[model samples]
Target: MTARYDEIGVGYALGRRTDPRWLEPVVSALGAAASVLDVGSGTGSYEPPARDVVAVEPSAEMIRQRSPEAAPVVRAVAEALPFASGTFDAALAVLTVHHWPDWRAGLTELRRVASRQVVLAYDTALHNDFWFVREYVPEVAALEDSRPSAPEIADFLGASSVRPLPVPWDFTDGVFPAYWRRPEAYLDPAVRRSCSALAQTAPEAVSRGIDRLRADLESGRWQREHAELLELPEWDAGFRLIVA
Candidate 1:
């Protein structure tokens, strides 16, 4: 688990940043909190701005890419946070739980360290709904277990709200699901490198999928099959926010 990020996360921050739309819900979940713990904080993408945030990460490569302005980060993993119990007002783990060696232990650690928790995760129910997952890179979808959802997250952390977060057609965060309307983005090797789905998948499989996607796009078949998506401004692609 520790080695996965260092290997796949070398350039994670280049295209992945906090979408401004995500900040409002995160701040709302924080609810007047002054301090926060950013667990599995990769390149400080969603670590809240202008707040006292202490980040815990295990990968030296990921740590190296962290912005100069990000919160002071500790070289550690989520399962064993170094902070004392109740050390902060809130804790956040955004799109990161799936990578943990022991997710349950990590969630319990979050509960122990903070009074409130804000987590962003994807619902497995809609995993196959993505065109890339359904058609191009089925191997990428095979990597996800049947666990990452709002209710499951709420159950783990005892959260109060587990609601969906929409993905803008031109979503700026560049998370895997954010490219629902912009399928061509997947063609760029640099763009795909930012998402673990592409970075971690079997190279042969990735090559096969990219060829299929490129063929579909060049043939105009991709646009014909998913024409409605172009008009929609934002879409619900199984992304959700859990707040407790």
Candidate 2:
């Protein structure tokens, strides 16, 4: 499992670095914390530039791929964070909870290590409503169905409020479902490789889907169905920031 990230995390810095638009809300949720622990901090995508950040990741390749100036990374998993209790003012898990074999244990570890708060930025079932799932890749939604619900995540963290921050389509951080409005990106091999679902899916199915999408774009079918998206600068695809 750890090896998967090593193989896939090589191009992560160039393809998966955090977008500034989404970073604003995540930083705001940190709430002036002096120090932060970034769990599953692949290639330091969302690590804040100004704050003190300690990143934890199990994949050594990911750690090596991190920005030269990124916070020092500790090779560790979220279920067993290598930090003392209340070691950090805040802890953040971004798009990584679902990847954990034991989600509950990981969340407990995050809550235990953070003195002030735990902020999670992830997707929910609401992502299924996006055009990509509704059109080209319904199987990806099925793959993510196993992820814990937002309410469940909030409850596990003893969260008083579950804030849902709208992630605009212009928010191009390259996580799954971020390219709903830009259907052509899916046809690109490099872009598709960045998605775990597409990367892991049966190659035959992926090839077929890509072929279908190409045909749709060339035949004007995709534009006819989602033409409204072309004129709009942004869209709120169902990404949210849950502050606990």
Candidate 3:
């Protein structure tokens, strides 16, 4: 997690800013927890404003980009958290579980530190089916094959509930599938750089896909084929929130 993020985490805050929409769900899931442990909290994007939150991130590059006003952070990995058991009311891992080298151990640490665990993850099958990935960068599917599946994570966590999380059309956070409707956003270098999926994918494959997408857009082929997406308010790119 540290090494990979350290290389690709440069200017991470530019494209991965917090979307106001996410706060409501995250805060609600946190419930009445007074103190929260945010594991792998990148740039402190979605930390609840009202909670006493402590962020843990391994990458100095990611930590360096955190706002001065953001919660106090510890340079640490999820598998070996430094705190004692039950140190917080809840543990939160947002779009971060797959990054951990040993996710089972990381989750064990989450359970050790907090009474409740809340994780944001995605369904690999659904994510791979996204038009951009299905039609363009098929390499992403292969890349994700090694990552832990949402069900696998849920089973390990003994999740109480798992629900679908749809990506809003104009999502503020520039996650991999944030621009499902606004396809032009993916063409931007900065946008692609912010997403770990594109950053980690084979550069040649990404370039090929981007070139094809550009040509399709110019020739009106993309608009003609995915016209239905333009009218939707949100899309299900296989995102899910798990609570245990």
Candidate 4:
């Protein structure tokens, strides 16, 4: 996974900027935690500004893009954190567990280093149904389904709560599912490159899907089909916040 990020993380910060609204649930879950360990923290985008945060990321390419003023970062993988037991009040893993080669081991390390764990995991049963994946890029769903599900992750963490994190229509994170309401965002090559699912997918598959999507958009077919979505302020893109 580190190698994968090193290859794809070029210009990652360009498309993957922090959306302040996305941090609300994460901070709320952190309660009174003074220190946070952000595992797989790419460019420190989601690390809460108020917390004493330390980031751990394995990819040097991604690390190179981090702001100089961002939280201090350690070069390490989630499976083997360098921190001692109970080093942090809470550990945060946002949309990154599926990238782990041994997610269980990584999550266990989170448990060892922090009293509480907050993970933003997706529920594929709901996520795979999103029109972009269900229609254009079924490969993304196929790839993601092989990873741990929300229930499985919550069970592993003994999560106290699992709540859906809906994607606002104007979401700025540029994650794979963040463009549910804005279909044309998928047409942008930078946007595609930013999302790991799209970046990892076969180019031919993605090209074909994008071509079809472009045609549909140009023909106004997509607008007609998903007209109902335009009225929604937010939609559940199957993002789940697990607090333990």
Tens digits of per-residue lDDT for model 3, 49-150: 889999999999999999999999999999999999999999999999999999999999999999999999988888888899999999999878878878
For every model shown, what is its TM-score relative to the native structure? 0.95, 0.92, 0.98, 0.97
- lDDT values of the candidates? 0.85, 0.77, 0.92, 0.91
Residue 232 error, candidate 4, Å: 0.8
Summed backbone clashes in each candidate are: 0, 0, 0, 0
* lDDT tens per residue, model 4, 159-200: 999988889999888988888889999999999999998899
Better of 2 and 3 by lDDT: 3
Instruction: Give the TM-score ranking, best first.
Output: 3, 4, 1, 2
What would the TM-score be for candidate 4 when compared with the true structure?
A: 0.97
Highest TM-score model number: 3
Task: Point out where model 4 deviates above 4 Å.
Answer: none
Candidate 4: deviation at residue 190, Å? 0.4
Candidate 2 lDDT at 93 equals 88
Which is better, 1 or 2, measured by lDDT?
1
lDDT of 1 by residue, 138-230 (tens): 887777654455667778777788878999887888888888898989899888888887787898998999999999999999999999999
